[model samples]
Target: MKIDIQKDWGKIKSHFRTCNRRNMHVVISSVDSDQMPTVTPIGSLFLNDDQTGFYFEKFATKLRKSSEQNKNICVLAVNSRKWFWLKALFKGKFSDYPGVKLYGELGEKRDATPREYRAFQRRVQSTKRLKGYHYLWKDMAQIREIKFTKAEKINLGKMTKEL
Candidate 1:
């Protein structure tokens, strides 16, 4: 069902946070020059209060290439935690949305501001002690902005009928 992206911004933000934690990343889909489609898994997406967000562009080579040609993109965030599913299964209904799809267009690709960089650091601070953290996020200096236009709550039979 259609969601009022502005009105439900708080819920959207919470859902995305849970999605990143449970699923590790959100899937971003874009089209190439020939209308060919591609999907990129991005873990650094952060939503602002104004229905806009950005993602670190360090390793998304294909997404960068495709975004240059086609700026339109779709982001899918799913809450796939085993306990969430198990609870819904037992109750025969979901208390909250299980997923959401965001429709947006790519904006400027620019260097992240100091504040943005700090936010990114905070997001990944839990993994700072890991060996791969430095290898993966040490050089995430650039970000591509996204202005979201619409949101759709995922529908799943009677499980999500109330939502």
Candidate 2:
């Protein structure tokens, strides 16, 4: 669908904030044997936004671990559906979709803030975080950029685009 990407980020960001059990898209960038950049999908990213870069809690999966070795990444996320997600990705690049992305390095830190601590507790107790969370964030390396795509084409079958 043709889209005008001007006023869709707010709606998309809201969706990411309230999602549960939804699979978020991740693009972990690393060097191949030849030292060229390689990107792939890694599941387990959770959105935590307050007033800065959207924070994500990730376990040590192969993708995360591999990315950790390189410290460069560009992650993507969108509400999933048959029609909306027609392609596994957009335009063969990181910023091709109407979603939020963070381009930077990775660092670890405690999920120690008061509000986050309680939320973590609830997550663990509610069986939401699976094995539970330990060092919270993993800092956003550099949080190089964070933004959303336009809303004119974010369709989900019967759900009209939120333009």
Candidate 3:
């Protein structure tokens, strides 16, 4: 069933938070000019209250090229914590939706504003002490906006029926 993106924005945000915590990244797929699909794992996607979000545009060459050709994209976030899945499997049902897909179009790429940069820092604060953190995220300067038009809950037979 289709999820009402406007009405379920909060739930969607929560699911993404869980996904980031459990999986550390979300998968984004876009089609190139030749209709070849490209997928990228983005660790910096952040959702806003208004059914929109942005991701830092760095280190994703294929995604950048594909977005240039076709703005349309799909983002998938799955709560893949081992415990969550084991519990669901034992109970024969999921307490909540295990995953969600958002459909949207990419907007203009621009420099990250102060507010956005700060938010990104906060999100990665726990990894700040690590050397790779500085190497990977210290210079996240560009971002691409996404205006989500639709959301769908991933269905897994009877395991997701309650959700």
Candidate 4:
């Protein structure tokens, strides 16, 4: 069964935790009513205590904060990749620990501790076997909300239809 975006916060958080298996989430973005949806692949999602807001590390994104344009977006997460369609949903809000569409604003983000920042940078350094990999980490474009529906919501259905 599918759950409403605002009513299924805990279920959505648990789906991303990968408590018993590999976990990953995909982020979707649409700037306007008529704009096309933007999808991003992510490996990590930070769910805070109390099931408030969540955070993820992204290297680059199509939307930047300087534009002042509202980025209507939704994030889809899954607990296991084995199940092609685990679960996902639409979301909005922007603040620290906000249950709804309130994941803090975009652009105005603080950097990890100087030491931690350096470590992240180093972890992204190029390797002999792999070159030209994107090694940048930036604050998530102020996410608005997250939904916990079948992964098919974004993949099999019209969740990403071009507007």
lDDT of 2 by residue, 1-163 (tens): 4343334434444655433235534454555445576666643344433222323344435434554456555554555544434553442322233344444445453344555445434544544454433344322221222232222333433333332
Clashes of 4: 20
Which lDDT tens digits does candidate 3 get at residues 59-142? Answer: 978888988778999999999888999999999999988999999999989999999999999989999999999899999999
Backbone clashes (count) for model 2? 4
Q: What lDDT tens digits, residue by residue, belong to model 1 across residues 95-155? A: 8889999999999999999999999999899989999999999778999999999999998
Best-performing candidate as measured by lDDT:
1
| TM-score per candidate, chains pooled | 0.96, 0.42, 0.97, 0.43
lDDT of 4 by residue, 13-109 (tens): 5554542135424444435333544555544334433433333335435544321465334454433343332232322221111111222233333
Which residue pairs of candidate 1 clash?
none
**Cα shift from native, residue 156, model 1 (Å):** 0.8
TM for candidate 1 is 0.96
TM-score of 2: 0.42
Q: Which residue pairs collide in model 2, if any?
A: 5-150, 105-141, 107-138, 108-138
